[model samples]
Target: MHSLRPLIALLSATAVAAPLRADAQTFEPLSTCVSSLRQELPAKVKPETFETFTRDAQDLRPVVDTATKTQPEFQLPIWDYIARRTDEQRVAQGRDIVKNEQAALASIQQRHGVDGATTVAVFGVETDYGRVRGAYPVIDATLSRACLNLQSAERKDHFFTALWLVQEGVVRVDEFKGSWAGAFGMTQFMPGTFAKYMSAADDKGRVDIIHSVPDALATTARYLRGLGWIEGVPWAVEVRVPPSVAQRWNATESEHGCLTQQSPVGKCRRVAEFAVDGVTRVDGQPLVRPNSLLGQQLEPSLNAALLMPAGAQGPAWLVTPNYQAIWRYNRADAYALAIGLLSDALRGSAPQRTPWPTDDAGLSRAEFRDLQAMLLRLGHCDVVVDGASGPKTSAAIRDEERKLGWVETGRGGQKVFIALKKSSAPEVACAAAVPASAPELAASAAASAASR
Candidate 1:
């Protein structure tokens, strides 16, 4: 649901455009699927509803399969991920939305016990202030995923529930369109979440997140509250970690501390504990201050996890449980960080003081595709070159790193690209020089000439 494009051009290219419906087909796979749904859903959903909806269902395997393979979370670097979501232009636009919708946001916050800025941040990031609610039909997407077994059991259940919602007339089938993942409306609520937490902001009793700003914000606020969002706590605070303190806290030495295997963002420690370790707010001020949100509302005893997105040399943050609430909206760490940073910017906070510690900075989609191609040629990976650095791609990178005697971080960067280019150049040259029919002979002749 949280799609971040690198620039405006990319955003326009990928932005939700006109709906592309699948051509009608027999959809043979869904026959048993509908029968299973009829048996499984009747207790909660009426049997009549299930029977009626299945009559018109069509296959959408192509669209659903393509989306499943290309999610940005596993591909984009942390910096690129955050930058695209929390761009300066987006922040400025969000601030304007906060100002224009002040009364509605304030009321939603008061009722739901969630902050206005955070709600706006969700809106801004999820759909770019509702400018790009996805163009895929909800029924087509959900039913396709359910019938084709595109996701896990629990996720398929959600898709089935969405179909049930359509059948029951809770959301009209024709009007209900959203992302390929089946999350709908302005804030992108999955059917299960919508069924549980949908709320109307006006007296009409119509909760339309797709069309109404107030309703969407209110629904988002209510959803966050259900996720344990504390009323006034800051999601995260940028921090400065002393060199000596960082040296003492080795990320790989223990499985329990910050940035460990078990807790990649570190375990939560009390603010006092961080103070003793010489960690301070990034602004060179005390962790608690009169004007700060923590000083105004949160207790000193609150625990926060230390997060370093780009290893120890990069910017650091003390992320609170409120951060977890944001993460619940989307499970990716980069997504959560983008929301937090965007929310901070809306409140007039400055950008990160410390830059990410990498010479190459970030990978473009083209660069990522090139990396995948090189890995494939080297016999390290077998995935399609779609620019997404998924599990197979990461494993391949680690394998290549090991071959080069480099540390196996499984990260894609300029160094890896350069090394791969150098390693592959001779092979490329040799293949280009020899005729395809007599490659072995050409190689043998070259070897003989070298020996002579």
Candidate 2:
């Protein structure tokens, strides 16, 4: 992830939700930004190009500012984030994509030494295989971020790059839309990143990442390859750590330490070193090269760092330099783990072996939707069943949590899901703010169905 953008994942239950209005108020005006940029725009972006493109730029500071703070990585619990991102529906869709786009994926692997699953996993995570390329115009989004952070050279460069892309007809002006932080395309590349790596995979013409799947995947593969993604090598492998070593190395306070400063196991070591230190493969395979890694001509001396995303007692992965490459892509352990797990799932690997240390486990996207629907039946709150946890959904879940006498986390965890699932009908005023009759009628209609 960009230093400007921050981390990825489901926002933690403890994260303080920022109201949109409060966040939006912090920004330089559009007129002020345009004036400053006219003089300070990078030399690579011609002054006239900046003037022509940003003339109609919208002040998106309010929305962008809120979005920057609400990134899931910094908010959601690790388990919830992983469950939502690597759920069954996403896995099935990834498999279908792997089948349909096999040729392009194969070509990418051949050309770049990047695996198809990893490439497609990035596709799934970035823009949901091009389904959810953001709504903000790249010009507006970039300009908004630039105005928000005047000292950030990356944000300013991205804005000008967006302008240059539009002016060159490489990206149509109408199609220049992306995230609040200004990343766009099927694989959500920042404008500057796209300019550097967005070449056609087939070498036929200019890469059209917005319109071409192969080109988007190609750009992603190229980036990963540039980041040193090793072919046929896993990013990491789930491992079992002996209790003796686990006690000494476990640092729940620094859960993402392996990716942040250095490995928590102190330093990167050869596979033999890990085996010697009592780290064993989870699947009863050799520590040096597990069965999943066999036939790849892998050596025992391949470097790996111990990654305990939860704690030493919880799931730990012996992450290789391949994991380092993926971490370099986003610099978040959860995001890299998502990519690793999703890619493995696409390749017919079973789900995660070791569970997180929490009893109130996370729900999948579909299960989350079901929870929302069940909440509606139990008169918890009337909200969309889209599975995205918004203010209304969180508040509703908190109400249910309060009813159960648990601490109010407001997260749609399995505890709330199971409780709501078993509740037959509306027993209380769902939303005291809303009319009591509304929830009663809806719950009455769905009562018989909810009982089952």
Candidate 3:
């Protein structure tokens, strides 16, 4: 637990460590950053190669800046995070993939210790099962990240590695496009990670995660194995928190356990310790002494942390090493939890036992689309029915929230959905139409999105 202090301190510093930014350098004159990198470029990445590829790279300052600050992982409530990603609609899609792609996934699992369900969960979450692999060019994205944080060697490494990929013909220059952070392809592998885990899944002998599903899934399985994923071992299990235990630890959560990263989540306490302290499975079954195979293999030396994401009042889990491995894939609790729950959903396993501690539960994509449709029908906001909650949607939600005499949360929560549905179809069907508003008001089109 104590060993993570230095790293936590470093992360804290790096979060605000862009001292190179001056009042004048507004992240423009890309050459200022690109020029400074001549000496920092990896030995394999030549200057001519850098100049040839990045000369016309578009500046993604606006997108990258917003993305870094408003990443869902850092900003979203845990329930919203899990609910939005692991809804029944997405789960059904994943199960179909598991059924159809069983042979390919089975081959990859035979090679790597990762499972089809978990790998497909990553595929589903990262790019909506390869449907939306981002729009930014890899060079532009990585360069933008590097320019944003000049002190980050890792960011610079990513940029140079992106160049190297283009130079080495790992991917076509025109085809190297992905997320704002330069993670590309079906499973969203950054340039560096792509290099680390790039391998052909089948006997085709060519690697193309972008165009091929097997390559993408196999690459993901390899990456998970590299990160210490254990097949059949549960990543987390829900547990009923004893009132006494909750009372003792709830107040000081941040200072004690995974909430603060003071203690690593994977090594918080032995299962026996938790059982001694009155922790039990959701069904009241006692955890085995030190060794456990309750659902899957739980090693004797393994430790488990009680993760009450929304404090003692909400759902809790004893997250394990498999969860830690997923965390490495994307270092955020929201993201990891989404992957975990989505994987469970893929296998048709039990859903989350406890609900989030809120009257207005988070909306799924389908539910969000329903909310968007309501917004359009009632002339609340001109939001696109794409189901994504963007700035324009947030503005609309805030406006409607004010009209409803509710505190403006800008969330398309259950309350908002119900209220909007009621207003969209006010009872008194077949009754005389109350004097309609202006024709334009009645025909308002909501084409934007709101917060979750």
Among the numbered candidates, top TM-score falls to: 2
> Arrange candidates by lDDT, highest first: which order?
2, 3, 1
lDDT of candidate 2 vs native?
Answer: 0.70
TM-score of 1: 0.69
lDDT of each: 0.64, 0.70, 0.67
On a 0 to 100 scale, what is the lDDT of residue 193 in model 1?
78
What would you estimate as the lDDT of candidate 1?
A: 0.64
Model 2 CA lDDT for position 343: 89
Per-prediction TM-score to the true structure, in the order listed: 0.69, 0.86, 0.83
Superior by lDDT: candidate 1 or candidate 2: 2
Q: Say which candidate scores most in lDDT.
A: 2
Question: In what order do the candidates fall by TM-score, top score first?
Answer: 2, 3, 1
Better of 2 and 3 by lDDT: 2
lDDT: the better of candidates 1 and 3: 3
